[model samples]
Target: MIIEGTVLRGPEFDPVEGRVVVEDGAITAIEEESVDSSDIVVPAFVNAHTHIGDSIAKEAGAGLSLDELVAPPDGLKHRLLRAASREEKVEAMRRSIRMMERTGTASFLEFREGGVEGVYALREAAEGLDVDPVILGRETVEAMEAADGFGASGARDGEFSRERNATAREGKIFGIHAGERDPTDINPALDLDPDFLVHVVHPEPLHLDRIEDSEIPVAVCPRSNLVTGVGVPPIRDLHERTTVALGTDNVMLNSPSMFREMEFAAKLADVSARDVLAMATRNGAQIAGLDCGVLAEGRPGKLLVLDGDSDNLAGAQDVVRAVVRRAGAGDVSDVVL
Candidate 1:
């Protein structure tokens, strides 16, 4: 198969008039030449962090505190998840996954709620879909064993040393939330030495130093922080220290759309458009260990083609800027994932 357009080729996302050739499911070649199409081909997105389990409760708790909204155990999100039937949850999650496909997301890293049952439900929801989910099961080591890894609620919630060790023993991903509300839990979360930290909204000098020294990655959710009244992560500060990626946290608080997350993050942070685009694409893939975030030879054939001539994006002087800060769902023409 051949897709002709202005391909944003490779991790640098350099624009060139070209065609991408795919055989089976891997990209074999990127041939540069003049093309008649006005399409912008970019790598499909990898959402670094998400909690799509509460998808059945979208926009349910407005004006709630960060803790009241999502702080585990008896948080409103947990209550909603417990209240919903498995069938209902599966259907809602399925719809969200389908929406992800339509919006050009190739994969997402999910902090799935419930336990082993929750992990299985998400797998059921995604059984026939192309939008892959990397699930980190919460609550139990058995859930981690059943899923891809363990997703701790936060350091404040419990002692995760055992779960972390179990995940390490199994060679699976281990992630935790830290510093969302304050700098208090950052140290404990860091001590576990997990694969990634989510929502480092209040990292202090010490935490930043530790992150830089450890070379751990972060998944920042700007929109969710703003909506929940927690301060947003310092993108420039985090990016300079270690790898930082973008995530749209909690379906109850925000839509699971990388385009919306990228636009919000780019305009809110004092970073270059290319850096923001990297946060939306390759940076997230880097955190999740996925191989399909960049357009390159011998990589997975996963990319989105947007109509550059569409009224929403027509005549944009900077292609990366337009995609990162201006383009929307309407600009998408085709998604090959």
Candidate 2:
């Protein structure tokens, strides 16, 4: 297969008019040429963090605290999940997955709830979908063994030493939530030596230093933080220290669209359009250990083609800025995942 467009090539997303040759699901070569196509071809998005198990409760909790909405156990999200049947949950999740695929997401890193059963449920939900989900199970070591990794709730909630150690022993990814509402949990979460941390919305200078020393990646969910009244992550600071990726967070809080996440991150942070695009694409792919998210040779042929000539994006001056800050699902022409 050959795709000709203004290709956003490599990690820096340098725009070049070219034709990308793909064979057997791998990118073979990118030949620079003056292509006639007005299509924008970039890497398909990799959503670094999500809680898609709560797809049944999209925008359900209005005017609720973060704890009240999603602190686990008896929280509104958990209650709703418990109330919904298995088939209903699976169907809802399937719909969300399909929506993500339609919106140019090639893969997602999911913090699945409900233990081992939860991991299997996500598998069922993702059945027949082209979008790949790297599921990190919560609650138990057995659940981590069943899934891709272990996702901790937060250090304030519990001591995840056992879970972290177990995942490390198994050579699986281990991630934790930290500094979302306050700075108190950041140190403890970092002490676990996790593969990555999610939602550093309140990182202190010391926490930032620790992150810098460890070179840990962070997944920021700005929209979700704003919805919960928690401040957004120090995305510029985090980026300065280590790799930073973008995520949509809970399905109940926001839709799992990398386009929206990228736009929010670009506008909210001091980063440039290219940097935010990397957060939505290559940065997340690095965190998830995926070989996609870049238009380069020897990489997986996962590309998102958008119509630059669309009414919304037509006559745009800056391609990266338009894609990150302005483009939406309606502007997408195709997703070759």
Candidate 3:
């Protein structure tokens, strides 16, 4: 297969008029040449973090506090999950997956609830879809063994040393939430030596120093924070310290659209468009241990093709800026995942 366009090549996403040649689903070469297509070819998005199991409960708990919305057992999201039938949950999750594929996401890191059954349910929902869900099961050690890794709710919610150590022993990923509502749990979460941390919206100077020293990657969900009324993450500071990726968080709080995530992250944080694009693409791929985030030789041929001549993106002066700050799903022509 050969895809020709204004290719966003390499880690820097430099715009090059070229064609990417794929053989057996692997990119063989990116040859520079002028082509007639106005399609914008870039690496398909890797959504770093999500709780897509709540797809059945979008916009259900308006004006609820962060804890009231998604904390644990009695939170609105959990209540809705309990009420919905397994079939309903599966269908809802399927729709969310299809929406993600249509919007140019190739892969996602899902924090699945409901234990081992939850991991299986997501698998059923994703059947036959090209989009990959790297599921990290919550609530049990067996759940972690059943899925890709373990996704702890938060450090303050419980002690995850056992889960963390178990996941590490199994050579699977272990991620935890921290510094979302406050700075209280940041130290504990960091002390657990998780593979990554999510939602560091309130990192102190010492925490930042620790992150820099430890070189831990972080996944930020800015839109979800705004919806929950938590302050925005210190994205700029975190970016300077370690690998920072972007995620859409819970389906109840926000749509899993990488375009929207990139736009919000770029505008809300003091980061360049190129850096934000990296967050949506390579950075997330690194966190999820996927090899398909950059449009480079020998990588997986998971690519997105957008109509640069579309009404929304025509005549843009900067390709990367247009993609990061302005492009939407309407401009997407094809997703080769």
Candidate 4:
């Protein structure tokens, strides 16, 4: 398959008029040449963090506190999940997964609720869909062993030493939520030596230093934080210290759309469009150990093609900036996942 367009090539996302040659689902070569196509080609997104299990709870708690909305056992989201049948939960998740695929997301890293059953439910949701899911089970060691990894709620919530150690023993990924509501949980979450930390919305000076020294990657969800009444993450500071990725977080709060996440991050922080694009793409892939997200030779041929001639994107001056700060699902021409 030959996808010709204004290809956003490599990690830099340097626009080049060319055609990407794909052979057996791997990008074989990127031949630079003038193409008569006005489509914009870029890497398919890898959402680094999400709680898609709450798809059944979209906009449920409109004015609830952060904890009241989603702090586990007694949270409204949890309550709704408990009330809904397994079939209802699966259908809702499936719809979200389909929406993600349609909007050019290649994969997502999910912090699934409901233990082992939760992992299997998400699998059922994603079955037969081109979009991939990296499910990190919550609550139990058995759940971690069943899924790809373990996703901890936070250090302030409980001691995840056992869960962390179990994931390590099984050589699976272990991630935790930290510094979202306050700086109190940052140190303890970092102490677990997790593979990644989600929502560093309140990183202190020492926390930043420790992150730089440890080189831990962070998944920032600016929209989710804002919706939950937490302050926006210092995206520039986190990017400066370590690898930073973008995530839509709870489906209850926001749509699982990389375009929206990228745009929000670019405008919220003083970072470049290219940096935000990387956060929406390759940075998240790195967090989940996926080979996709970069448009380069030998990489997986997961690409998003947008109609450059669309009314929403026509005559754009800067390709990268336009994609990051402006493009929407309506502008997408095709998603080759």
lDDT of each: 0.93, 0.94, 0.94, 0.95
Stretches of candidate 1 exceeding 4 Å from the true structure: none
Off by over 4 Å in 2: none
- The 10-residue segment with the lowest total lDDT in model 3: 34-43
lDDT of 3 at 78: 92
- Model 3 alpha-carbon drift over 4 Å, by segment: none
Ranking by lDDT: 4, 3, 2, 1
lDDT score for residue 254 of model 2 = 93
The collision pairs in model 4 are none
Give the alpha carbon lDDT tens digit for every residue of 1-337 in model 1. Answer: 8999899999889999989998999999999999998999999999999999889999998888988998768889999889999999999999999999998999999998889999999999999999999999999998999999999989999989999999999999999999999999999999999899999999999999999999999999999999999888999999999999999989999999999999998989899988988898899888888898899999999999999999999999999899998898999999999
TM-score of 2: 0.99
Compare candidates 3 and 4 on lDDT and give the better one: 4
User: Which lDDT tens digits does candidate 4 get at residues 1-337?
Assistant: 9999999999899999989999999999999999999999999999999999889988899999999999989999999999999999999999999999999999999999999999999999999999999999999999999999999999998999999999999999999999999999999999999999999999999999999999999999999999999999999999999999999999999999899999999999999999999999999999999999899999999999999999998999999999999999999988899
Q: Per-residue lDDT for 79-112 in model 2, tens only?
A: 9988998999999999999999998898999999
Over 4 Å off, model 4: none
Question: Tens digits of per-residue lDDT for model 3 on 81-117?
Answer: 9999999999999999999999889999999999999
